[model samples]
Target chain A: MSFSLKKDKQGVVVVGVDGQLIVGNRQELKQKVLDTLESGGRKFVIDFTKTGYIDSSGLGVLVSLSKKIREQGGDLRLCGLNEDLQTLFELTKLDTLFAIARTPEEALAAF
Target chain B: MTQPQPPQPPQPLHVRRRATGGDTELSLDVPSDLDYVGRAVELIADQLPGGPLSPRRIRFNFRTAFAEALANAIAYGNHRDPGRVVHVRVEVAHDAVRVHVTDEGNGFDPKGVPDPTLPERLEREDGRGLFVLKSLMDQVAFNEKGNSVCLTLRAG
Candidate 1:
């Protein structure tokens, strides 16, 4: 898996995940988001437009990151989940816990 | 013009295929490493025949569930020991695909696993692997020792 991180003009951190997010590379994602959180970037959006798949390890890291971000009084949103991912989130009942948007712009607007 | 590329080396996977009647059996032995999980899943996927299930359902359901089973075997069952190996046996039939994953560690009771969907446990980072495989696969069964699990997906 690969990840890209950038900030919008409004100072919202947008993280892009490319390829499958599974046990092999979940830590890299967590570390990147954690590094940004440490740097005082509050509002965040994780874009899954290019992500093809995610396993339990990937889901675990997202939950951990979301909790960490929320504990610091910040918020995180996810956008561009494909149908499979949507089903996964729904099956796990994680959709209720995360703020999901259709696009990065929509997610950024919410924060 | 681009230079001709060399033939790629074969993957470090042990595959033995045997045909019995209309069914095919494949066996693989991989090290207990998380890195091998994806490749193993892909190898198995390539061997699956097109049945009544749609391509999208086969891809998503099998990939997700198989990956989860391999990851669980490597990380939890074998404790990520490099010396340990995970054994995978697959039976591909006309109407279904079945896989068995066995690890080296002392197994735990499947029933003892707490429900991750519980409101109180929703935020927990671990313990979702079993839940995911069970949810996506048509049947998920654990051996009495719990060290081995069988995941089956039926053609619909």
Candidate 2:
């Protein structure tokens, strides 16, 4: 899986994955989150609209990043999760853990 | 293990698209046209001998297994060489399909992952890759050879 990141409106960072997020690339994704945090951005809105699918590892990466940001006084929200991935979030109760929105703007507004 | 393209053609995919097999193979080399693993699973499912299955089941399992194996190959397999080759083989028999996805990267110790179900892990978001694979597939096995890892999954 490949990802592109950009900061939007000073508070939101958009992360897009080119394809599925599986076991192998979770570390890279997690590092992206850490890098963003180290660079002074706290609020994030990860966009999964372009991502085809994601498994537990991908989910874990999101969770780990979100947790780390939260501990550092920042917050992360997820947007555009497809049906299958949305179900996974709900099943694992991650939906409750992270602030999830229907769109990037909504996620940004949430913070 | 080696796939030779025709002398004058962009037919590798077209030919493989038509060929059916009981072999379980996942190629990490992304074909420009078929980049996503979902498409690969569809291609593999089409080649299965059974007439067909419920669209929902097929779609579900395809998403699950494809998400698990293909992601690993893409993210973990070619980390060192940037441009590395990953091969996948599938064995479809009467009861189930056994798929083997091999990568060119060193495999990790599976035992290192924590159980997400542990009380302390209830709020943690990581450490669920293999767990989910084990839960979804009938079986999942990992083997290491030099810099390559062979991931096996069984689904009946």
Q: Top model by DockQ, which number?
A: 1
For model 2, the superposed segments whose C-alpha errors exceed 4 Å read: B1-60, B66-115, B134-156
> On a 0 to 100 scale, what is the lDDT of residue B61 in model 1?
85
lDDT of 1 at B86: 94
Clashing pairs in 1: none
Q: Candidate 1 docking: what grade? A: medium
Give the range where candidate 1 chain B is weakest over 10 consecutive residues by summed lDDT.
Answer: B49-58
TM-score of chain A of 1: 0.97
Across the candidates, what are chain A's individual TM-scores?
0.97, 0.91
How big is the positional error of residue A50 in model 1, measured in Å on the Cα after superposition?
2.0
Q: Weakest 10 consecutive residues, lDDT, candidate 2 chain A?
A: A18-27
What residue runs in model 1 are displaced by over 4 Å at the alpha carbon? B1-11
